[model samples]
Target: MGPTRVRDLSVAAVAVAALGYAVVTLMYRHFPPITALSGMSLAVVALAEAGWGFYVRAQIKDGHIGIGGGRLHPLVVARSVVVAKASAWVGAGVLGWWVGVLIYLLPRRSTLRVAAEDTPGAVVAACCALALVVAALWLQHCCKSPEEPPDDAEPAAE
Candidate 1:
């Protein structure tokens, strides 16, 4: 399969943002208060993915096809790619959701006590989601094999 497209992610984010905004607008009063740390889980995942990406890149660069002296299965890389793609999409959607909520909340922060209190959490969440997207993309890139020169290319003179 081809790499994940930014345009597709963008569309998904926009759609989800609209939906999230509508839901929040209609049911915000019934929802519990957002805590400042509510979105930190995503950040943790992002850090893990980034670390994995570095490890994968190192293993591949060293021409070692294994984990800790064992052969690295092709499926592992494929699975990593899938996970990265999925995480990127999820992150985009979440980022969009937070942005939408911020759009609604920021203007009312001055007039609404709840909105004021929730703004910091939303901002934090949005940043974490963005980090996830970046880390996932990095992981996906690290999983790619190096490119080979084309057969028709001329050899350089010694």
Candidate 2:
């Protein structure tokens, strides 16, 4: 497949955010308190992806061989690209959700103690989701093969 489009991601995020905002507006009172750690899992995943991106980039730059002298399989890179694309979409959706929640909560924070309490969690979650998107995109970039030179270029004279 081709590279993930930022335009598509943005549209998805906007749609999800709208939906999330509607849901939150309707059912926020029934939901439990949001904790700061609620989004930590996303952050953890982002970190893992970032590390993997670095490793894969190094391998690709070194001619598709690992630092340990093992060849990097094509399937492995394909799988990584899939994972990166999936994670990027997920992250965008989640980031939208948190943004929606924050939009709703921020306005009411002064009047509602619950909103004030949950604001921090939503902010943290949004940041974590953003990090995930960036890391996933980086991973996808790292997995790309180097560009080939134009076939029409003249050969160097001996």
Candidate 3:
């Protein structure tokens, strides 16, 4: 499969963000507060993904940093690409969701104490989601074959 495109991710994020904003707007009274624990969890995921991306990049370029034989197999690189694509999609959705939450809460913060308190957590969550997307995209790029031409390049005639 091809690498994850930014255009696709942007569309998905916009769609998800609109949906999330609508849902939260309609049911904000029942919404729970954004806790520090939840923010920490998102940060943990971001950190892990970033570390994995670095490791994958090293493996793909160097092929001498992994376990055992210190060489990355082709299948492993393919699988990593798949994981990166999936992670990008997931991260975009999550980022959209948190952004929706922030949009709804930011204006109401003056009147709603909970909203004011939760704003920081929502911001943290959104940033972490963005980090995940970056890490995933980097991993996908690392998986690309060095000899392959750029996407804009025309193919040679047979």
List the candidates' TM-scores in order.
0.90, 0.92, 0.84
Name the lDDT value of residue 74 in candidate 3.
Answer: 74
Error of 3 at 98 (Å): 0.7
Alpha carbon lDDT at 16, candidate 2: 90
Candidate 2 residue runs with Cα over 4 Å from true position:
65-69, 150-158
lDDT by residue for model 2 over 24-106, one digit each (tens)? 99999998899899899999999999999999899888796543458788788889999999999999999999989998999
Give the winner by TM-score: 2
Q: Write the per-residue lDDT of candidate 1 for residues 1-158, one digit (tens) a residue.
A: 99988888889889888988898899889878877797899999999999999988887777766556665677888899999999999999999899888888999999999999999999999999989999999999999987766877778779
Q: lDDT, candidate 3, residue 158?
A: 100
Go through the candidates in order and give each one's C-alpha lDDT: 0.89, 0.92, 0.81
Model 1 ranges off by over 4 Å: 66-68, 150-158
lDDT of 3 by residue, 1-158 (tens): 77799999988888888999999999988977787565566567667767776776777667453446757767777887888899899999998898888899999999989899989988988888888888888878877765744677678879
Tell me how candidate 1 scores on lDDT. 0.89
How many residue pairs collide in each prediction?
2, 0, 0
Q: Give RMSD to native, each candidate.
A: 2.9, 3.1, 4.5
Candidates 2 and 3 compared: the better one by lDDT is 2
Q: How far is candidate 3 from the true structure (C-alpha RMSD, Å)?
A: 4.5
